[model samples]
Target: MVRNPLRAFFMMLGIAIGIASLTAMSTIGESTRQETMRQFKNMVGNYDLINIEPGASATRGMPSLTTVEPTLKFGDSDAIVEQVSGVKQVADVQNAFDLNVKYRDRTTAAAVYGITANWLEMHSYFIDFGSVLTDEDVASVARVAVIGPDIQNDLFEREDPIGKQIRIGGVPFLVKGVLVTRGAGPGGSSLDGIVFIPVTTASKRLFNRDYLTTITVELIEPLNPEPVLQEITAVLRERHGIIPPGEDDFGFVNPRAAAEQVAEVDSALTRILTGISVIATIIGGTVIMSLMLIAVSERRREIGVRRAMGATREDIMHQFLIEAAAASLVGGVVGTLLGVGGGVIAVLQQSMPPLIVWKSIGLAVVLSIIVGLIFGLQPAWKAANTDPIEALRS
Candidate 1:
């Protein structure tokens, strides 16, 4: 390193870049994965839950067009809850978006959902105060509303919301329930800026559409979702008059399964990137090996003097190998620090939570060192085999 700083710097630069790319890719992938998983759990999703929406496309990440006629309905939720085996609970949800909500002189735009009486159980949510929707409320299409905690802060302003009259979409609704505080749901949005009403009331008063936007199903204990999936598919197909060869116009969104699949794909991509990094490391090693070979050729006199002082062939090989490994090792450390630091900053600047992965760091350093050893061997061998007398003559 003292005699050939420039060559060592070039060699280290290559290895450092390789390590940095590898680490940065892994870190970014994992940070996104973690955020996705957190959002999945925060929303109306869990391993036992299944979401039924209108779509038949097999593609991922592409938005599917909704049919002119809706497919999933409130009756589907009833059938799933009553007839389907291995089913625990079911909720039918119909959404009215960006509607005006009013209480006394205060008015704000909020989303209103017409959900079943079992909406709380479906979302694992509890009532902070007041009462949840009842079967009677659904049957009679009662104008009762359950406000999330944020609505409480906004409209109620610490006053008791229960028994208060609020206008949702210009329809009068009594504040029957108040939901507990839920900070953030999927996509990093607060759950509080929403109102919940009975599906019948929503159908009669709000959207006036008989079809549901979503059907949420929660399965019984220890049951695999596959059987339930088949059962529900069969039911939906029969109801919708679809034959075996035809596909249903509804799609299933299983968050847990999707999250797992996402993780699998991310792992595969990371492996590919890691392989590319390894190749880069090997190229760096090749450069170092070539430089060492040139150094041996140019320092023939020095080698001869060392040989005269009783330095063995093995000693010469060890010295050259150590120098190559040291360069790569230093590169590895610098790259790890830079890569991790960059990832943290990028995630934070984007308003995402940062996650540090120690395994990637360790892997980068270890791979770099291994690359140095494997590629350094040939040069070390040639230097070791050099004849002292021939080198002195040259």
Candidate 2:
């Protein structure tokens, strides 16, 4: 390497780029997968939670926007709590979107949901300050409201939002609490840009509807939700007077089903990244092999000198192979550092949580070594087979 610095550097560069690209891809992919799982956990609260909504849509990504009369209702929530054997909690939601929300001099359009008091607990949300809605707030059709962190920042600035009145849909609502920051939910939608009001108040005053948009159920044992799901389906079917042969008007977002969907997407992404990494490493190895063959030709006289001094063919082969392997091994080390830096930059650009998968770095090193051995063999063999008498003449 010292004798031919430029050649060694160029050979190392090829491997460096290949390993770096592979490591960066794997790191970014792992981070994205973790972030996706976390977002789903936030939306669903627990693995045992089931989100049920009325609609005929084939997709479970979002609840169907069905009419109030034929869809889920507040009554379904009561029935689910009473009839389901292993039920733990039922949270009913009635939401109206893109509403004109106002507080003194600030105004913004946001989503609003009328929710039962236990909705916060079921969804794993906590108040940063003040208090969450109580049963009394839902029962008396109180005009109290809880706002998310984004709403807090936009409306109140440094002023305290607690005890302050905000108007939703032209009706006065007292701000009871401010929710902690929740960055995004499904589909990258903002979660902190919503407001929560009492379910009764939402039905009677704001939207003037007695139907529910969704019912989120938390069960006692989450390991197997089959029996609970069946019970829920049976109860709703009976209440709606639907026959078994006909398609039901409602759909369910089962935790296991949603998890499978997430895993599928993650798997597809991993395959694409892994394919790219393999291609890069192969190209890098090919470059190294080509360079080594050229080096062998230039150093033929050196090999002859060693052979003339009693160096065996095996010795020549081992020297060249070891040199090639060393280049790739060093490159792998440098690439690991570069890859981590690249991944951090990418994640920072998107404001995602930072995480490093050390396994990817180890894999890069191991794979690079393998590439060195595979591609270096042919050049080493050719160097070893050279005749000492012919080489000295050259």
Candidate 3:
């Protein structure tokens, strides 16, 4: 290796490339998985929460302002709470999109939501100022509203939003509170660009419809949501007069199921990338074997001289094997440095949360050494089997 620097460098380069790819891809994969979960949590609250909507195609992960059909009613929400066991809280939701929301001279089109008093708590939203809606407000159909941070910024700007009146589709509503900033949801939708009103007020005053867009349910802690979900389905099916094998008008948006789906997709992608890296490592091993064979053929006379000078077959084999392992070990160290640098740059460029995987780095170094030993076997055998008398004559 010292006499032929170029050959040694080429042998190390292949192994380095393979190890670098494996380490870098594994680091990126873990970061992506965590990011996916964060996005899901932002869109839907927790694993024990489920949203039931009035259409068969409403198995969405995020809340929507529009519905395909209007079959869900306020009574459905009441029935779920009364009949379904392990249910902690339930809220009926009504939504209207692209409504003109105005605060004095400023105006913008935004989604308006009408929710029960427990809705904010169910969705894990905290009020930055003032207070949430009361049951009395919903029962009496009061003309009051809660605005999000985006709405506050768009309409009120520097002025105070509380106590000011905003008009939603030509109806005046007094602002009661402002929600804390939630940033963005799935698909970059603004979670704070909306208004919240009492469900009764929305049904009787704003939209004038008895149908609800969704029924949000929160299950009790330490309880399995599957049983509660089945019970809720059975109750809805009976109420809607649907028999077995008959198509139901309602669908569930289960947060747990959605989260599992995201996890599965991430896992599959990681497996495929890892497989590709393994293939590259194998190809690198093949290159090492081919080059070592050529070296053995060129240095047959050296083997004969060593043998005549009292070197045994085992000694000859060990020398070649050690040389191969040394090259791979050096390559592994270099690859690890390059891989870590690449991963850090990727996180900085994408502005993603940083996550370091030390286990993967350790595994990559081990894999390189194993590849070196396995591929060096054939060449080592050829060098060890050389005949001293025949080689000296040649």
Higher-ranked by lDDT: 1 or 3: 3
lDDT over C-alpha atoms for residue 224 of model 1:
66
TM-scores of the candidates are 0.86, 0.91, 0.91
- Alpha-carbon deviation at 282 in model 2, angstroms: 0.8
Compose the digit string of candidate 1's lDDT tens values, residues 210-316. 78888878878524677788898888887878897787788777766666776677677767876786677677778878887887788787777778799999998
Would you list the C-alpha lDDT of every candidate in the order shown? 0.80, 0.85, 0.84
Among all windows of 10 consecutive residues in model 3, the one with the lowest summed lDDT is 58-67
**Can you give the lDDT of residue 65 in candidate 1?**
58
Q: Weakest 10 consecutive residues, lDDT, candidate 2?
A: 57-66
| Per-residue error (Å), model 2, residue 59 | 6.3
Q: What is the lDDT of residue 18 in candidate 1?
A: 77
Model 2 gets an lDDT of 0.85
Displacement of residue 388 (Cα, Å) in model 2 is 2.2
Per-residue lDDT over 106-130 for candidate 2, one digit per residue giving the tens place of the 0 to 100 score: 9988899999999887778899999
